[model samples]
Target chain A: MSKEKKKPILPMIIFGIVSLGSYFVLFNQEGLVTETYTKGGWYAAFPILTAFWFSFVHGSFGSNLLDVVGLQAKKNK
Target chain B: MRKVAAVLIVILMILPMATAVFAGGPPPKNLKKGIFLEVNEAAGTALFQDSTTQETSTLMIGYSVKAEDLKLNKKMMVSFEEHDGQVFIKTAEVMFLDLTLTKFISLIVVGLVGGLLSGFIGSGGAFVLTPAMMSLGVPGAIAVASNMCHKFPKALVGSIKRYKYGQVDIKLGLVMAVSAIAGVQIGIKIQKVVLDAWGNAGSNLYVSVVFVVVLVIVGGYVLRDAFKLSKNPAAADTQSKLSLRLQKINLPPMMHFKTAGVTMSAWITLPIGLATGMLAATIAVGGFIGVPGMIYVCGASAIVASATELVVAFVMGTYGSIQWAVSGLVDIRMTLLILSASLIGVQLGAIGTTYVKDYTIKLVMAATMLVVAVSRGAKIPVYLQDLDWATLSPTTTAVLNGISFWALIAALATAGIIITGAMIKGMREAKQEVQVEESHSKA
Candidate 1:
């Protein structure tokens, strides 16, 4: 009897929605983003914070996305 | 106990260095970020509101700034010159651009490939990404800022993955980064002097010349080493004779890098880190020198050097990003757009390392360095013409520019193919071994 491995479908879907949603919101508010993000001073934190936020959200999505596609590191012997 | 104390001392030493140069090099002179409220073309001036202070000021237009280029009520980044106490707008650039499909795809593709290269070799992709963004009509400064904004997060991800594999040496990375930061300051000062002396063309010429010379020498040496190791796969990975000899020197403050499996004097290690930082500031690709320096001089294996490089990249990238962001130069749209794909690509590349041998990493790094050297070399003639040192026809200039761009694409494609091929091959062999063992047990 052979057993098939399960795909990370659930996590992929969850992160995919969050990632896409983030992009949608950012692009929709492009004018406000440009103004606030480039303000400099204490406001300079805007771009740095946004980058960290995406790295967590979209970065996780990408990881799950790769697993769903079956691209993963080989098991160590 | 001694090791912990040494590490603490190192951290303490680095803190003051960080605080001293945290502002990073020198700020660009006469540059301002603001929103244009109104433009009076007839009067050759515009009502500009500073983004930070929200203060209103009339900026006199310079002769080079065409009246039609001024768009009312748009965010603009401008450079100014004080002529007899009158502020003249020397150059103006739109801070944000409309996100079109072509640009989005281009950025994602480049980011993915660049992330892959970075994950595999520790540092790369930025050397090409900055120029690629500029080609897509982003200003050089903005392209650099956005590239830096994307770099740290990607490097952070890569470093975390490599750390899980037990390949990262945090101490070595930190020690190097501390001095690298100081090196970046000095490098920037040198760049400013060159820019002030020679203008944009001169700067480009200087950068390209350095790129070609360094890449050729270092890439050639690495490629030769990779070939030697490829021919002798059974041989143990060892420190070079240079590193072995240097390790014998009884200099004070001898440091031990646990993961890299080498102990050397701080005197030896600090210079390598400093050179890495200086080159990073100069050409925006410090990894080319940093990795090779670790492998050849510091006596770390390519794997350790590359993995540790992710740490260096993380530290320097974070520091550099903050400096650029504080200047309000980072285009977050471009940064996020690149991150969307690079985050994925970096993870894949990091995993690829688990499947391949050390020489494979060196092979990819060498190939990339040589190809990128060619790409930069193609731009030398254009810079020469800009400096009035040489003349070239417009057609020739266009062809060279095309070659320069395509050569970068070629470098990325070549690296991607080699990495994928090696990973797949290694995985297949591992699977075969697993099957053989299972069959034997069943029999």
Candidate 2:
């Protein structure tokens, strides 16, 4: 039980850093990002792809962060 | 292999239809996103630099636009009307608001609560988040677009989590989504007819009336079913009588949905999906009808219904976001900000489901629907007054508006409290059970 309870601290830290880095890059390049993203053709894929990318990276970071903090679903019978 | 191919073929067929139909409805007409460089109130014109092309164009402001409303260097979305081959700005407003500390915090807070509710109920956030953003001074079109942009990712995360828990029925979700796309087209046509015939006020009245009627009827039924299930635990997982009767019909093209554990004819399932889509186009929250329809009409359990609704949300939201994005309506900054907190909230809510019974989901959903009904109900009189069908004093209008807004907040707050409380109780019970098992092993 003790071994099973080990927290996922390392993965959480790595994902947290990567997620924050991605956010910083996007925010810093807002002008170029907004311009390229809204061009109304193939450029439409930009927002959808970006959303998926963030959901994967940031979403993993969030899930790991919760597990590290000891929030998890109870094992079903 | 055959089943997989069939599903893929269906999705491929529906994709183009969805794009063509839903494309023309939302984000208003001839709208352009740009930054306001100069507002020359004296000349009734403004110099706007297009965000996409960086081209500066002087636009003639319509009579209703106040010079004070135009802020320099702020992102703006302007709607244009072509009169005598000259384009004039019919409406112009700031697209993205300044992200001050207070507004930032408020958005994150609402995102978290809205995310939690969505995770629990399968469809939420848009009903409240769009209004919340509009109240913060974001243009209505941008708010809807940004909200849609955030929705798909959030739904994607929640659906994947629930899928892992064996709650989602992918086949059912896809079938429903395909039919829903068609329904949205019809719903949009109805909306356009109303808007053209009676204008914005009539449109608002139509939406409010539909909102109240649907919420009251469906929410009351769900609440009653939830109460009955709570009273008799043995009947908690039983299919509704309506669903059982529908399933008995030997209609052609019967589909088996394994996760939902239901086998029903295509004829029955498709109508529910279509209605869900129609309601979604009208109210911007299709899950209100979709989840209930799945449970009571399609013989799905509440858990499966809610989880499947997430799948439908993912499909529709992704499609809608792309439409809005191409039109340059989505404010990515706002979308990402909401996603930042909602991702966390959604994961937590998804986990919360493991600890509670199926009735709990129905209860939360019903409670939310009823409260939201009150919120929209409060706006009906205001809309009627706008159409000159009813007269309302300024103070009365103000009070009704306040009730409408606060009722939305109340709905969010109530769901949050119920989810959190139930999760804590569930976790405690599980911990105690684990402790008891440990003691038994020692003995």
Candidate 3:
């Protein structure tokens, strides 16, 4: 039941930027991350939270990108 | 009233199973997680600090351990054994893996294809990804842990997409997931038993045998059923006789799943969940069995069953991730790298499913399963070589390993092709139909 968005390109670019930025930050601080994230115990939430954040930002971007490319689900028949 | 009762009963059944399993804690493996506080090569000993207890121990350097590789003040996971009343370090690994360009690209590629398969069929990618990571020099536990960490998110994104298509059955998926969680415990326990009994080679051989046997049987049956359904479209919507008979049973606590459109006793779904959990624990992919079980045993259509599987995957993956996380083994960089591509692949696959028929899902799943069976089957002889049960030439072992890795690639590639082809064809036909309708209306 996902209706076609009027202009997915704009939102796609925005999300793409955010997702890429997130990755950039993650890679930029690799040593700090690799240390803290793998510390076990309550530090488990770090990875879980990161996974959710990317899935939302990156996931939406992927959905819209697919829409822009005309690779969409069949309209409700 | 009955539905609530049935669900509660199911939960009651699951709680005890989970507690019983969790109570056992992880098998008493000699592996410990901590940091190397100091090393004295001349003394043939190292002072190690336990992360949890803040206690230090003097561990003797075993013959297999490379003393030079031990860095002071670095967090690590190591397995040690008692050799002649002295605790000896066996293999020590740095907690985090060094991800090079090669490792990054490979993770992304596998994640994309694995995501596509998961979005379309609701389960896949773990089986090959774990081994693929190991090949890239990741520790076995870390590879499995990182792969699991990625799986939940991918499944979350995928399930949402599929749910939008109204294909996912929340109640049924939850029912299966709760039990599947318990089953993972048993699976881990069984794995521990195997490892303790026969070591790595024996474990690999056990996993490979189970992988090949299950895939051949389930995949073969699904493929056959797909052919039958494709030829006879009228039978597509009907539940299997097994499902129908099971549904007819006048059992107490019969739960009605609206999305799946069948009412069945809660008891029936538990075994499937347990089996799925056990297989997932053994082979790293439960969707191979989960989807088929939902279809044939629970009487859901392929579309619904596959979509619902994402829910199960999400729950199980999250649970698995937490377990790995508590052990601090999840490699987030590898997880995110895979997600970088897989998140896209999953959505694309989810939409692709909307453009195709149910049979296409089955066909793709069957093909992947059979090829994956080949991938694991090829590794059997090499595992045999390791166990000293069979002496394989070096060339033979190398060739077999090559075939095994490539065959996994083949499985994903085959599924990707089928899904893409079907979606494209479906889109073309839909567009053509729209154009025809527009023309007729204008006239």
Highest lDDT model number: 2
Residue B152's lDDT within candidate 2 is: 93
Grade the docking of candidate 2.
Answer: medium
How do the residues B114-161 of candidate 3 rate in per-residue lDDT, one tens digit apiece?
Answer: 899889999888777888888888888888778888988999999999
Candidate 2 has a DockQ of 0.69
**After superposition on all CA atoms, how large is the RMSD of candidate 2?**
2.1
lDDT of 1 by residue, B1-443 (tens): 57656765876676555632321233354688788888888898888898788899988885768677777777778887677787787788887877789999999999999999899999988988988998888877788889888999999988888888888988899888888887887888888899899997898899889889999999999999899989987653777999999999989989989999999999999999889888887788889999999999999988889999999898888767877887788899999999998999998998899889889999999999999999999999999999999999999999999999999999999999999999899878877887888898789
Q: Against the true structure, what is model 3's DockQ?
A: 0.59
Off by over 4 Å in 2: A1-5, B20-25, B36-40, B49-57, B81-87
Q: Write candidate 2's Cα lDDT for B1-443 as tens digits.
A: 57757986988876876753342257665777777888888887888898777899898875556677677886677777776787777777876566888888888999999999898889887899988998998888888888899999999999998898889999999888888887888889888899999999999899989999999999999999889898997998789899999999989999999989988999999999899888888888899999999999998988889989999999888898888887777778888889999999988888888889889999999999999999999999999999999999999999999999999999999999999999999999999999898899889
- Please say which candidate is ahead in lDDT: 2 or 3: 2
lDDT of 1: 0.86
Docking class of 3: medium
Off by over 4 Å in 1: A1-7, B1-27, B82-86
Most DockQ-accurate candidate: 2
What is the lDDT of every predicted structure here?
0.86, 0.87, 0.85
